[model samples]
Target: MNNPPSGGAGPDLSVTIAGIRFRNPVIAASGTFGYGREYQGLLDVSALGGICTKGLTLRPRPGNTGNRIHETPSGILNSIGLENPGIPAFLEKELPALRELGPVVIANLSGADPEEYAEGARILGASSIDMIELNISCPNVKAGGMAFGLDPEMAASVVGPVRRAAGGKPLMVKLSPNAPDLAAVARACVDAGADALSLVNTFKAMAIDIYRRKPVFDMVSAGLSGPAIRPIALRMVWELGNALELPLIGVGGIAGPEDALEFLLAGAAAVQVGSATFAHPAAMLETIRGIRDYMEKGAFLTVGELSIRQKSPRARDRSGNTGSPPQGG
Candidate 1:
């Protein structure tokens, strides 16, 4: 894998999360990048640090109906409801090509229940996928997604089963920003055997369609994502980084290289570019280039060094008073 494209002379932008070394720290967020094939002709998929497939479930779901997406000033609300082509179909059809896509392939796994999540993980555990992104924070789904993520005990209950079922594969739990106690949930996931954590899933939001005198989406609430959520997402990453020692993948409204640099500086080992990809397909690649440039200019040799959380005493002091207290008392 050490070829010209993967290996060049510059400040290394690569990041290693959960023992998986990505070529760079700019990954395509799940739901935005569909299985890495939809964007095959749009940009060089191999140039990405990683690709997270759409949220997958044990059984095929038709997803929610009636305006699953709505655009806002700086973000979009979505109620896709985990609509996906069951795990079996993904294993048979998508996994093969995804294996050849050249970037780290992370399966964004979700389900309606703990057992369903476990079964899906069991199936994926035997596959050749690079890592498993345990998505316990999907806000739009009513059944189990965010339900399992909101509380520390609830999150641990779900993570324990999936962890054992993952067959020792790297497990990175995606978190919901809506959780009342986000740090407690992170600590629970880690205690339950999670290797890494990604933060700031869309906030729960809604909009009214005055013309129809109804809601913009069938479900009254949907997941909010985009530049509108980036600042808050960065703060969440910063808070978690100060509280835990796990690798973090920051997601939410990351549109450009400067935005991504903010998350890394706030302590994210990697940043996932989502909504921006809809407007610019090469956003991730541009971010990768931008990060390399930033690193070179700052004399930061590795992605880990880009973190100002631990290296700066001021950041540490600020973190102590940021939000709620750190994980353990």
Candidate 2:
């Protein structure tokens, strides 16, 4: 038998975020892909728009002591505590290999305070990394973790200096779902200096071991992610898209193309795959293929085309009601 349609490139999957063009809109999220080294020999790294490295700090961290990750009904709660080998090691060890392997490399930087954030950005910007993702939304740590992300002023305090430090490179701020006002916080980051925004980082969660009579994680609380947060993430993306004019990346619990499509239609410039990678090593590659197949079937030529189709007037409010103009006004 002849080749049974293994499939080749079908449509133009390229997407641009903050003036950076990615081969596809599906990018590997930080803290999950491990600096693009783990996925080596498993999938084409270059096929992705970019790779967001595990959240990096100024110094190496030992991470949480006790139980780290726990599987829930439809999601995973993690207390990894931003475990990383620090920025110096990443530059000296991981950056070269990733650059050689291809794909746009985005460095995810985190710090306990604004100074640390600026310093890390200043250092990473000097490297070959194509972009910097300021992970201000991490909820696992106790110090300045989500504290800097929840309030608009606090978000700006971290973003302004980092953006100035990373003047030459794209500086994207990752938004926290724990914030009382995600849209206001997003605006603050942009007004302060962020080049792009990524929304709906894992929700705050905790799991108790009833048999053990204690918390499952040493940190007492963890970040909940996976399919469980998809609906919330999608709603935020749609609202944030309506609020902000800059490029927004949708993330939370995307496991497949259908989830990504919701984000795209809601106004995301791209989607980041996180927890699903743990279950399937080739999840991102599969997502890319599925997206291409969906586009081809729908006769869609570009991601922008697909995104536009869903930007109609049928948008609903948080109450699940159509948001029509006021009749009395």
Candidate 3:
């Protein structure tokens, strides 16, 4: 019998993020991929561009109380609360397995304080991971999560120390969609020495438990992620990509290949698959194939060959304005 096709008959999907080259633009979002070990038996982990490990802290955390997740119409709400085995245990156990995956490994670090942020960075800086993504935008927690990301001054302070501790590894400061002015926050992180930026961790939202007449989770609020957030994430990516000179990793509710393509068209250097993985563990691989097929059908030679095509003046007029509208409008 004839052998089945190996790779997609499409354009190359290689991309670069903050000087680190990826064979493809598909990366697993932090806290969603679980350190690249869980999916090893199901898929070829090396086929991915990189793996952003679960958000890590200086000390282990048990996470939030009962009912950490709830399903929404087109997305999911999570109050995971940055629970992880902590950095030390991760370095000892998870790092080795990830190294075997071939592609770059980006450690996602979060902490309750600035010093802890720096400490986690310093510890990971000595490791073999390719980069570090500072999770300054997680909104599920009560303290030190979205707090650092929402305020420009606090965002800079949180990122500055981590940037210093990153050693030679590229540091990407993940921003929050909840920020009043995302571009301002992006500029602050860049000013604080962030090597790159990642837009839109998630939006703060909550689902009510109709039966209990309370919130879905013990926490009154949670981070909403999935298809419902894509448009907002794409808009933010476009805003930051057009305004800032730094590289950006687009993230939010990227559910499939088309969503990833939209992000790239909006100017993201690479895209991360987040909530989609929960429902489709092979979503990242499928998205990679889809992107390749799209490029091939569109006559694009490579992912880099694509650019954020700005609309003409006439087109902009027809589309109204390009700037962001006031919040809650």
Instruction: Give me the candidate number with maximum TM-score.
Output: 1
Global lDDT of each candidate: 0.86, 0.83, 0.83
Candidate 2 residue-wise lDDT at 327: 18
Candidate 1 residue-wise lDDT at 237: 93
Least accurate 10 contiguous residues by lDDT in model 3: 317-326
TM-score of each: 0.92, 0.91, 0.90
Give one digit per residue, the lDDT tens place, for model 3 in 259-284.
99888877677899988988877888
Q: What residue pairs are clashing in model 1? A: 226-253
Q: Which residue runs does candidate 3 get wrong by more than 4 Å? A: 1-10, 310-329
Candidate 1 residue runs with Cα over 4 Å from true position: 1-7, 311-329
Give a tens-digit lDDT track for model 2, residues 1-329.
Answer: 11111346676787777667787889899989998878776666766778999999888877888999999999999999998899999899999998886778999999989998899999998999999999889999987778899999999999999988887898888999999988889989989988788987889999999999999998899999999999999989888877866778899899988888878767677899999989977778777877787778877776766664233356542212222221110
lDDT of 3: 0.83
Candidate 1, residues 1-329, lDDT tens digits: the string is 21223346877676777778888898999999999989888888888989999999998999998889899999999999999999999999999999898999999999888899999999999999989999999989879999999999999988999999998799999999999999999999999999889887899999999999999988899999999999899999999888887788899999999999899878787889999999888788778878877777777777776766644333322112121111211
Candidate 1 local Cα displacement, residue 308, angstroms: 0.8
RMSD values, in order shown: 5.8, 6.3, 6.7
**How many residue-pair clashes does candidate 1 contain?**
1
lDDT of 2: 0.83
